[model samples]
Target: LVPPDILKKMYVLRRILNPMGTVDAIEFLLGKLRETKVNAEFFEKMNT
Candidate 1:
């Protein structure tokens, strides 16, 4: 029931949500929002 333009935006959002996706302005913004507070333990837990 969604419009094509909205669906396209959703697809773009999905791509940006990919944790290891290619770097770009959106990814840079996401990284900035991280506050440099994520720890190695968090990554270790995710890797499991």
Candidate 2:
């Protein structure tokens, strides 16, 4: 399990990086990592 302190830091970073939200920011990063072609199946699972 993730520690609360770490989660808080992630939240702060997420807010600063993208006002859209953490999930969106994660997806955006993943998309970038995959050259803007993130797998649809993986994305769907992440959203669930």
Top TM-score prediction, candidate number: 1
> What are the models' TM-scores?
0.39, 0.38
| lDDT values, one for every candidate | 0.53, 0.56
- Once model 2 is optimally superposed onto the true structure by TM-score, how far is the C-alpha of residue 48 displaced, in angstroms? 29
Off by more than 4 A, model 2: 19-48
What tens digits encode model 1's per-residue C-alpha lDDT throughout 1-48? 975655665566556567654666577646654744564332323312
RMSD of 1: 12.3
lDDT of 2 by residue, 1-48 (tens): 765655565566556557767787777766645753554433334322
Among all candidates shown, the one with the greatest lDDT? 2
| Candidate 2 lDDT trough over 10 residues, lowest sum | 39-48
